[model samples]
Target: MMKIGIVGATGFVGNRATEVFLAQGHEVRPVVRSASSADRLTIKNLDYQIASAFDQSQLADAFKGCDVVIHSILGSPGLIRGSVEPTYKAAQKAGVRRIIYLSSMIVHRSAPAIGTTEASPLVEKQQFPAHPAKIYAERKLLKLREKGSVEVVIFRPGIVFGPRSRWVSDLASQLSQGTAYFINEGQGICNSVYIDNLIHGIQLGISTPSADGEAFFVGDRERVTWFDFYRPFAEAFGVDPAQIPSLPIPEFHHSRKRELISAVTNSQFVQKFLASVPEDFKQNLKNIVPKRNKSSVAVIPQVEEVKQVEHKPTPVVNEMMAELQQSQYKLPFDKAERILGYEPIVSFDEGCRLSIDWLSQLKQFETILKK
Candidate 1:
């Protein structure tokens, strides 16, 4: 079994990586920032090292004697300037042989209709704050690979989702509460990578000779509109899919403007105005963005009859309520099978059931608290 050192092992991706490696019977040394954070990683037959990624001496010590090092550190846009070089040098000084870095698909050039790929012009563009940093980090890894025999593999995945995930959990919560929205007709196509599948891809990179010193796009072959992605979630939750309403793009934008204005004009009134709006509006806005490639294009709804629906307790609002009343959150899994040679052992349907069960238990506990 390979002796693997996992930096940021307590993080979302790093934790998953540690689990995968341990399951493969590899000896894993999980590097965490604090002893408290180390308690969360309860994997059997694994060792833990406490160190901050930014601390060169501590990182170097943690990486010593590892066959391969997986750098799973998170960064805002412009990570190249932030952490890449320091981590690279640390790994080199630690005598590490290979490095696997997790990056985002957004760093690649994207087509007008499709998402970005390894060969996309996005690799050259320095527009987005995140892209430049990701690209620079990947480049630095490549340079290190060229300078020595160190093998570097860059895995760029898009919209990673799974249990205990920030995005997926939030999405499931919104759908369960009957409070989700689509932006601009929600036609923007996006690539999604199931976290389990991502782990599989990372393993594949480790074993595959061709993957060394190269970058690969790790995502499900199934590309869908933002709306379609959420529709399955409704079905999974045992809700009426048709009850979920689609908000007009213009109206959503207007609401956002109002929210910004309220926040600026009256801090005290901001909370009240926000409370009056839909609970899911903020979460929905956070997830949805206009198509990056076709920024000006709007998603035109296919059904004209549906468009005439009045905007009071808006049809969209009523639809969400009805859907919530009937259904529960359902998770989707397909990308793992076609692309990553794996499938989510935990289905979205199962996830919804568990979440609801947990919530119900929490509610019961709260009732006891009141007594």
Candidate 2:
């Protein structure tokens, strides 16, 4: 059994990876930011290290005895270089053989052309916010791969949904609140990869020689639609998809005036100034607006003019979401299939069955419902 060092071991993906590897009899060294976080793991007699991905010293310490290391830290674009670069340098120092970096299908646009592969260009200018960071990390690590010190394998998965995912938990909240709805009647296909299926892909990456220096895209074999995906969850939650209102496909509008004002107001220079404003003073401005009727208050002329131009929709999507919902992005994993011989063992249906079982027992559902 190989000795594995898992960075970000307590996270949704990292914890699951830890469980699967440990169950297979591999020696798992769970690297976390604190000792208490390691308590999340059930297996005893395993090594644990208190280390942050941001700290090179701690990372080197944790990675010293590992044969392989998985970089699964989730963070913003700015945080990617700081975390991933140090891990690479440390792994080199520690004599680690291979490193697995978790990326996502989101590196591409929502509606990529059919048969898109790992070599496809990233959504370089896309405003998804996280895309740039993921792409940046992949490039940085692949550069390290060229150095020949450590073999790097990049695995990208799509719409990862299961328990502990925002997709499930947030949808649960929306269902309970009667606010769950689809953009464009939910006709688009969801390129969903179950959590277990992703773990299966990770397993293949660990042993498959062909996977090194190559990227793989993984997904469920089943062709499930957005409607099909949500319907089951809605029914399990005792909610009806038909009964939930659908919002119109929103037009893309990023108001420069509003953005500028928001940026200025939220800036450090203005934070204290805004906080110092009297609550009574703010209330009096609203109260001072002439009450034309019980339900009607006079809007300032400038405000009324601005509102006419704002054109905000009931909100199914911003431009980005609309772009996604309008088309199908079926990510073909033929390359992963051919090279690594990775096939999704847990079919999407069976995977969902397991997920529903977990959802029933998750404290996340309880906490969300309480909220």
**Each model's total of backbone clashes:** 14, 0
User: Against the true structure, what is each candidate's TM-score?
Assistant: 0.65, 0.79
Clashing pairs in 2: none
Error of 2 at 365 (Å): 5.1
Task: Give the alpha carbon lDDT tens digit for every residue of 4-99 in model 2.
Answer: 999988888888888889889998899876665677765655688977666677789999889999988775454554577878988998889899
Where is model 2 more than 4 Å wrong at Cα? 39-46, 252-323, 363-371
Q: Distance from true position, residue 114, model 1, in Å?
A: 3.7
Positional deviation of residue 130's Cα in model 2 after best superposition, in angstroms: 1.5
